[model samples]
Target: MNVTLTLALFIAAWALLDYLKPQFVANLEDNILSFLLAIITLVSFGQVVARYGFNTGWSAALEFNMLAFSWLILFGMSYGIRTRLHLGVDILLQKVGPQTAKMLGIFGGLLGAFYALIILDGAVLSIVGVDKEGGAITYFAKMYKVGIGVEEMKYPAFVQEMFGLKRPHVQRWVVLLILPISLGLLAYRCLQASWHIYTGQCGSLIAGHEAESLVEENRGALKD
Candidate 1:
């Protein structure tokens, strides 16, 4: 469907931006996450203040918080990988020689990249709701065809009128748009890490030996 094609184009455009202006891409990601957190925090705080002070609160506050949290989590995957925050047990790497560990680390990174691709394809196929991939209509297409909007999350009246939509609520498909995008970012980070390891730029995958480093940093303090 056109919706899928458009989203795919957006993904490609994002990849291009990532290639050409990596710092801008990084700033964009950080800003998005920060904005989401700000929204969640402000909405939650307003709800609490209203409820306690005036015995009235926004009914949609909880739902809005949930939405913001979901977006944060979906988009945070790549950030975690980019910062090497996603750690794993490196027992085998520890036991092996440095060269062997390096290879194993590269293999692990490739595995992560493969896993991201698998998830991305599976999500697209599941959302498309067809036996096969090509020539299939996506769930977003179907939702648009029916023009169903989400519950408790409303668009501004002007937006509803401008779009000529029957309902004021935001669409479900729009909220879920982050899924594929997040997975794409995940795959890119994995491959990037793999390449770095292969080129002797990064030491290994999965932020190895973080606990050891933390312990070392605080060792003298504990004794004191």
Candidate 2:
């Protein structure tokens, strides 16, 4: 058994667990975000200290930090929706009655899903080059065949040999895969919110602090 391939397969197993247990997936996303954040902070701090105090730093530090930031933002987009952390302007929603607000929220969810679908389509097309014959092919396959690699921080020779890779550099396609994954997650959450609203399990698709709370607080302040 190839140890490298086995390690990759083990990592991929998390996707299966995501489908089987959504809560597990949610926790996984949170943990991944936290780890990325920590890495970014530590690396950036080290880079600063090395540049100023030691008069030296890793040349690839900026590139690695950028990659980490991109991953965090992309993954956090879906996590925000899942945890109802996304801010929404709900003035109109609050003005309406419960039934009307719920219906409008469902409509908004559909629109969000549609927007994500459009983004996903464009990203996929960009990643996978089109054939002259107008045939479509998988981007991952093309990337693998070409052995594309990142400009900086190439993988070690041993890792390349273990994976039978022609290039020692990190694969660009692997990072690009986050585009589809995050978009898919966002679309799924949009549909989920719509369903919840339809079933009366959720009052609104846009989650935020209720307007009534602000009004109540203001009234209490006036009395005081």
> Of the candidates shown, which would achieve the greatest lDDT relative to the real structure?
1
Candidate RMSDs in order: 4.5, 6.8
* lDDT string, candidate 2, 115-210, tens digits: 665565444334347322211113444554676777786777788888897766688767666665666667777777788789987766544654
Per-residue error (Å), model 1, residue 151: 1.6
Can you give the TM-score per candidate against the true fold? 0.81, 0.73
Clashing pairs in 1: none
Clashes of 1: 0
Give the range of the ten consecutive residues with the poorest summed lDDT in model 1.
Answer: 130-139
Q: Give lDDT: candidate 2, residue 115.
A: 67
**lDDT tens digits by residue: candidate 1, 50-152:** 9999999988788878878988997898788777777788888889998998888888788887777656554544544744342212444666577677789
**TM-score between candidate 1 and the true structure:** 0.81
Instruction: For model 2, name the residue pairs that clash.
Output: none
Candidate 2 structure lDDT:
0.70
